[model samples]
Target: MKDDKQLEQTEKDKRQKAIIEMIQTGKYRRQSAIVDELINQDFTAVQGTVSRDMREMKIVEGKDGSSCITTEPLQDMHRNELQRLLRENHPPITKILLFTT
Candidate 1:
């Protein structure tokens, strides 16, 4: 048996991989129902968190059908809220750099 931390990391990796595969196969759109099924199939994670994980995986909501991970959206900074994040959490770069220097 693995230690708790190792087990956690393994689970995280598995969850991430599963999420990616599902998104690629056009499965991420199914939502809570599928998540519930995964949970029953021994995925020791919550459905709510799985939904959040989809966001972290860069899965985009589509109009025609389900969500999928798109590298284009990931690369296109203009289409995302990244700028708002920068504006909201613009840390003191000078202070950080001063410590490093």
Candidate 2:
């Protein structure tokens, strides 16, 4: 049921996720290395796509000057923050209202 554009975007997202995991492992230190790994994994991506994905994801150099993918995608970052806020703050307020107040 997915259209061509939708399928293309899905594939792009999958490739980006795999890149992030590889970067996190510190094994793919260079863009070419990442591309090679992706190819090995059967993902058809080129260096340019990988470069764009890194830039879009806000991947940056670490303190040691190594490529790092520490920033989560904006959607993921927002979701995580929302979950953290709810987990840390919401339950206590509910408990106070139901049991103490």
Candidate 3:
């Protein structure tokens, strides 16, 4: 049972990696296209599966009105938000060092 679960996770990882590569190419404009491509590659896929992958991967449409989907913008957004929260909530480095010492 454990081995089966590991195999399933490995397959999911491969599929998501393929999805990332396809999205990076900026050719697939929609989830259906991604699903079709995955099918062509002999991987079992459906709209729901692709949609979940996109959501989990933080994929979003390009900001320039293009059909391309990418994770770059979402990554930047998350990075900036994290920085802001850290700036607001984190203690000073000196304080941290003093506590550790």
What CA root-mean-square deviation does each model show from the true structure? 9.9, 8.4, 9.7
On a 0 to 100 scale, what is the lDDT of residue 61 in model 1? 70
Q: Which structure among the candidates has the greatest lDDT?
A: 2
> Could you give candidate 3's per-residue lDDT for residues 43-77 as a string of tens digits?
88999998887777677666663344455645654
What's the lDDT for candidate 3? 0.72
lDDT of 1: 0.63
Q: Highest TM-score among the candidates is held by which one?
A: 2
- State the lDDT at 26 in candidate 3: 79
Candidate 2's TM-score: 0.68
List model 1 lDDT by residue over 1-101, tens digit each.
44798667557656666666666666446777558656766887677778777677677777876776777534533433464357457854654334553
Candidate 2 wrong stretches, greater than 4 Å:
62-65, 74-101
Better of 2 and 3 by TM-score: 2
Return the clash pairs for model 3, or none.
none
lDDT for position 29 in model 2:
81
- Clashing pairs in model 2, backbone N/Cα/C closer than 3 A: none
